[model samples]
Target chain A: MDNENRIIITVLGKDKVGIIAGVTAVLAEANANILDISQTVLQEFLTMILVVDLSECKIEFDELCERLNEAGKKIGVQINAQHESVFKYMHRI
Target chain B: MPITIHPDEILETIRMVELENLDIRTITMGISLRDCADSDGKKIADKVYDKITTKARRLVSVGEEIQRELGLPIINKRISVTPVSLIGGLKSEEDFYQVAKSLDKAAKEVGVDFLGGFSALVHKGITPEEENLMAVIPGALADTERVCSSVNVASTKAGINMDAVLTMGKAIKEAARLTQDQDSIACAKLVVFCNVPEDNPFMAGAFHGVGEPDTVINIGVSGPGVVLNAVKKHPDVDFGTLAEIVKKTAFKITRMGELVGRVASRKLNVPFGIVDLSLAPTPAAGDSVAEILEAFGLERCGTHGTTAALALLNDAVKKGGSMASSYVGGLSGAFIPVSEDAGMIRAVEEGALTIEKLEAMTCVCSVGLDMIAVPGDTPEETIAAIIADEMAIGMINNKTTAVRIIPAWGKKAGDHVYFGGLLGSAPVMDLNKYGSKKFVSRGGRIPAPIQALTN
Candidate 1:
């Protein structure tokens, strides 16, 4: 998978067990490669951000976003997937 | 190396777009038509059309592609050419009409919503060609679907050309009469300027100056809602802290604009012009400049302290925007067009805002008397007087200002005129009933002010 096709998946909501498992399960089924992962919790509120390579994903980008959003809803969290360019332009020069 | 992405910054940007109405207001391509000039008006018209379409062919498609790829909401893609009066040696109104038609057609071909530079800069005096163009403005505007026209009759160095001011007042009235059925929407496409900017991406005042490159891309950024939301978060802070917050928010917004300008410039192979950081508003509720002023503790936009609040906002925006982009030009400040801003319209409807207060507010802001609707029966001399007053403000203060008042045909004070889309609707605002015929009729150039002798 080419590096330029990398996408950012953010999961933000209440902290709970198996939240990572629930999110990775969706990524694995969609054939997305998780290149890096970060998670932090504050006062029982969880925030997890994953950098994933979607170049080899079986599902289309929009479909993958919807699937991840649906999975997050089932797990009692809010999730979003957006192109890495959105981050690069906003954060970097 | 893998790029490091910050989750908070990404979320903030997404929230600004999805919730706060942050978007690129326009990406205007400034195309020079100097090379297209000819002794024959008809031949000149053909060259103008060819130059615009050939230079701006990819503007819209490229804008759409960037919007989709970067997840940015680019609201408008437009073109600004060299002011038509500078091209084509024309002798009559019909010749100017042909040029307007050609520009309108080329804009349609390129899919741009509005094409500016159907303009004349008679700040000092008008040439015969400029006078003919002025004579045809009424027909040119009423005939074209997407052409925007402006006449700069004043500047700090040139003072105010009262003759041109008087002419424009009559021209505006005729334009209103011709488009009476559309509630005088033709006047909405016209602007009168004092010290107008060459690289302004927003219309109906954009025109490529004679000094600009053959082609360049200028960007106008809009995010009044984002600034309002940022201010809302620090409600308990003092004025100094509030100013800092506004500056930081403006920094983020200008960064987005610069990024878009860089990308579009690279794609179009045109030099990147300045990023205009004007907080332009729309009829949309969350997107308003007046609301930002109201957020600054003004009970209403036109009440006492409105000028001070607006002055703070304008200064902070320029400070932050200038830091974000080295090429910042154009009128980079808060715009207070009544019809286009929901909060300003409400203020006017509630008798909280008036033309007098708006004039005072313009003393500190970017543009003046923008998108205001006046009574149908307002005398042309009175309209000219209003313009002369605003132009005097620009000339004296050494700032850019403009007037775009619409005399909604057959409508009086308290009656509403709808222009649809981005122009929004406006209640025909009340004007001073006092006569200014004698003042406007005294037509001659007001000499350049003492400030002009900077040399």
Candidate 2:
């Protein structure tokens, strides 16, 4: 009901090609803009942290997760999308 | 700009990351029910036990489920009911054993591991019924399993009850003798407390007092593993950085405690008590508060470096946990129970640690002088000294604290007492045998210090 426009998606698992491009392309097609990005590879584990603006996206948070889930299956990674508020509460407060 | 980090800073940070694996071995729930007015003492104990089992039945399972589902492991699920002495007063004098039996049965039925309440608090004086219950305590614990007990013989608020304290000192010896076949393991289940808090989520001290509501749920969250992992992550961080890292990580771990405690209370239908953010270390590898100290630049715990590092970690954990939850109470800091911690057990075995060093650490942490193993031949006066030193810290600091020492009967110094499971094991250490005359002869109250009155 509140600010449903913000979202954060974390992708983990394998490290390969076009992950950033593929996810960002989906967001770009859905009209979402990337606000912040941080990624690291710790001991062969690929971890990506991202914050995105999803107001203009073609689908909602659930729909975006669904689409990302599909792409995740193809890329051999797990992509999870949570609302920005959940992410903020988890990391900030 | 590049952050400039010193070599000492880097080493300190590494030590801290390594420390996070230790956790508060347990958060025991004390439920007080002095108001149980059943005409039959049996029914009263039954009702009280039911209220506890009903309130806490799902505690262990829920904690285990959360450990797997949420990845936040709860080290123990325990309940402390009202001190039996209060309910089976002189009026209800005839029904003490039945109450103990009913209490133990109910605890086992509900899957609760440690049920506390078979206790009497004679800080200033003892009544006939209180005396009777005190006599029963030695036998109650020896005959039954799972029921842990405690007595508050000293308190700064009430001053020390030397008469009752003397009685308990003798009682502990009798308990040790009674359970000598079990290596005096039953004595290990009893605690001598000073200024005992009503809502302690630890055992043998957790008895639901009469003052508590019908049913309430309290959770103790352990994050030594998290802290250890964080310390390990920053093999290059400094002492200050390590402190900051441990604090932040403790903050997150306490938050997990806050979340799970609230959720468990809601699910089980009980009010939530404090989220004790104690880094209760365990016997498992990497789960030692001593290791945390080692990670903080001390080669091992019990050295000069150990005290300051433990103080830093303890204070930071309290500050962070208090910020996370408003109702935080009990001994809400790190714990250094010797028998339960692997690194601590190793430290004791290695001769790098001593009882005095552990005492110093207790001055700044949650509980004082916990789970230490001493020689079988260690005299009772020394036990009083061991307790007196701990009680002094609590009385002087005006905090709740206790001492649970196991004098492994027949097991001399350097021998090991292995109870296994969460009780872990402890190496029986050398102790002073000369102080019996001085300690036991000072039979009067250890008067409250002038500093205690200022507050």
Candidate models: Cα lDDT each: 0.90, 0.71
Question: Candidate 2 chain A — worst ten consecutive residues by lDDT sum?
Answer: A83-92
Residue-level lDDT of model 2, residues B383-446, one tens digit each, is 7767777777788787777888887878889888877787888899888656754665566676
Each model's DockQ score: 0.36, 0.09
lDDT score for residue B165 of model 2: 65
Question: Chain B, candidate 1: TM?
Answer: 0.98
- Give the per-residue lDDT of model 1 (tens digit) for B1-455: 34387667767887898799999999999999989867787788889889999999999999987786566799999999899898857667788899999999999999999999999999999999899999999999999999999999999999999999999999999999999999999999999999998888899999999989999999999999999999888777888888898888898898889888988999889999999989899899879888888888989888999999999998998888788886998889999999999999999999999999999999999899999999998999999999999999999999999999999899999999999999999988999889999989998999889964556
Model 2, range A1-93, lDDT digits (tens) per residue?
224566556777878887888777778877787877777787877767667777567776556767788888888887766444332222446
